[model samples]
Target: MSELILGIESSCDETGVALVRTREAPGQVPELLAHALHSQIEMHQAYGGVVPELASRDHIRRVLPLTDAVLREAGVALDAVDVVAYTRGPGLAGALLVGAGVASAMAAALDRPTLGVHHLEGHLLSPFLSADPPQFPFVALLVSGGHTQLMRVDGVGRYALLGETIDDAAGEAFDKSAKLLGLGYPGGPALSRLAGEGDARAFKLPRPLLHSGDLDFSFAGLKTAVLTQAQRLGQALPERRADLAASTQAAIVEVLVKKTLAALAATGLQRVVVAGGVGANRLLREQLDAACAQRGVRVHYPELHLCTDNGAMIAMAAAMRLQGGLEQPRRDYAFDVKPRWSLEEISASIP
Candidate 1:
């Protein structure tokens, strides 16, 4: 019988669960049987950023129902699940615990093995969930609220960090910039939407560190540039808001695309994969797509749903690890959360 893995993700504001069945034979892709996600956007809308305690509470409330829903949708008995996988780290500690606790307990009850999945690994591998996934040995740009990194992904579980943010991540820059413009919470998407109506040339924001000849990114300076421009305007000019948004978005996208290209060139990898929430930005996608097209480099991204935190990617990563014969969870093993986990620390054998 094919091994069935139950995946749970609660690294932040979303509670997700999924079931994936491995192929009967080796060297074949796993099939996603069911997937469910519950976003706490409305719950956190009042807060500018996520509240760890509230996020953990919400996950505890929704995870069980979501797991039930996914199992029912897949017509898979909980007892039949071969493994349980949960996001293990680099997220709000409290939130990570909620999922890890539940997954470990559930797996114990089912007498099945469990796996602790790295949150970023889930994001990096998400593109595989899409049709026409890129092959191994590609460059991955992981841009999100918490991280901005360039990685060399030779295969599953094998990731080499090429460059990363020295300060605020690109998505954090977007959110902060949007907040300065009076955009609501979860500002990245809101700001991107407003950017669509603005003139990209109107504000002329700085493209920080773009010419630094270093793979390291520094968005803090660019964010400061936006602040300086806003101050120069002397007030929130409602009419110019869109223009500012567009200009900021343009500068950010340019930096990202250029840095990714640099990474690709340095690594000599023709295939590039974009992951994380910021990867869903239309402008970034367009610019990267165009740039890659010009250079004969292929760019891959997860489908819109997989671009953000989700369980399918967690399950996929766990399945790959298990298949690769990585260490399995022991029943006596305790649940632990890594609030500051690093991607380079992930075991190399699974990738």
Candidate 2:
């Protein structure tokens, strides 16, 4: 029988819970049974951004209910779970603790072991559970809410950071630029939607470090350019906002696509997997698809719904790690959550 793994994720504004079944074969990708998520976007809408304490409180309110919902949807009992996993780090301290504490407590109650999963790793490996999963040894472009990185992924647990944003992340640039245009909270998607109606070339925006002779990215300058342009428009800003939005999306996408291709060229890898929330951008997918197709590179992405933080990715990651012998679920139950652990902190070579 496959091992039933229950995963929890409360790294940010969403509380996610999922069930995954790890096949007995060590190399097989786990199968997702069911998943549930509660987003705090509406709760934070009034603030124009997430408040950490509020997010933590919401997670506390939602995690268990979501877990119960997942288990019910999966038709699995708590006693059936063999391992429990939760996002351990690289997020708000309070949120991380909420998930870790809940997972550990649940695991203890069931006499099951707990595995602490890394948040970025969940995003990176998420494509494996996609309809069309990419093989190992691919270049990965990870663009999430707070991070934008290019990495060489040899296999599960083997990740080499190729390049990353020096200042603001790609998502941050989207949100900040949207805020400049008076787009409401959770700005990225709103800005992207507005951009579709305008001409991308109407405004000339800076593509910072596009040709910096390396893969490192810089979006801070681009944000500054957007701000300066918005200020210059004065009273006419609203009329030209869509064009500016289009231009802004274009600049970020150009830098991201170019950098990703550069990483692929440098790695000499033909497969590329893009994950995280920004991967859902229609423009990005279209442009990257065209570019990668021209280069004979196979591109993959998590399902649009899975692009955001979710328990399925966390569960899949934990199952994969277990399959790879990368980490072990522990019965000790005494756990500490890390708010700033790096993806590179894990050892790639198995002991």
Candidate 3:
């Protein structure tokens, strides 16, 4: 019962392609064979944010080539693929269409089945791509540039929403604050790198919803505080930018960590899975590890590279869903993408 799955992802600025092999045993974890990713970071850097049209065009150019490279790297033939997988929703419509179109076309030409994957579900299951994967019945903290959410994962396709951001996500807060401090495009990582050089206690910053008696998050006030601080510093801003960045990161991380712990407590789950791009934050990992360890709770993260969106996660998610009987690949090639889909909707869609 081995099946080769080819996965495509173009939900945003990255065009990714990967191959994964499902094992004979239904419970065995799917294995990643080869994967390729092309990030639009450098191209988008000029704009200080992603430009959807350019992103879609780049995806159109990159997806096929990346798919070729992946197949070569894995030493697999296109005809050997049993299924073609692609990111379906919760992303840029045009970008999503590029991947969906390519994937469905390939599957149709090869006479193979196709699976449409949710972008966040790929993020949620990404940790399985790591050397160490968590068991079921765990709490998941999914923080990315556009989303921040906590959920109780009972098993494949079984998820319960615990809490989520009410305003800006953690990654948004990081990037927006970085922009406010004059850091250019892809501000989150830039702010994080600069934060390492400054003292976290240098400035007092707001930690939104830290004591709201609920698991919801709100980072708008924190971003506003950062804006106010930058304005107050005025000409001296450059001299103290690192401190501001550090303090801002601290504020965001503190809220994420505390809320995750609260979610674990509420769900009574002993393990927590951290996924998505923001999970790559060194400080967030350190703080969460420290806090969770004291309570004898295990924390798991995707391999550093896998924390960002990639085809491996997409392939892995599709494979897992199929293995769990949660999804069945369809033959119809006509496909659509969801540009504004939410996790709540994903939960509702799960059978």
Q: Tell me, by lDDT, which candidate is best.
A: 2
| Positional deviation of residue 69's Cα in model 1 after best superposition, in angstroms | 0.7
lDDT of each: 0.90, 0.93, 0.92
Order the candidates by lDDT, highest first: 2, 3, 1
Q: TM-score of model 2 relative to the true fold?
A: 0.98
- lDDT string for model 3 (266-332, tens) is 8888999999999999999999999999999999999998888899999999999888778789898
The alpha-carbon root-mean-square deviation between model 3 and the true structure, to one decimal in Å, is: 0.9
User: Can you write out model 1's per-residue Cα lDDT over 21-127, one digit (the tens) per residue?
Assistant: 87767666778899999999988888877888999999999999999999999998899999899999889889999999999999888888788999999899888
Q: Per-residue lDDT tens digits of candidate 2, residues 165-235? A: 99999999999999999999899999999999889999899999988999999999999999999999999
Is 2 or 3 the stronger prediction by lDDT?
Answer: 2
Candidate 1 minimal-lDDT segment of 10 residues:
324-333
Clashing pairs in 1: 156-351, 157-351, 158-351
The better candidate by TM-score, 1 or 2, is 2
Candidate 2 clashes: the total is: 0
Candidate 2: segments with Cα more than 4 A from true spot: 348-351
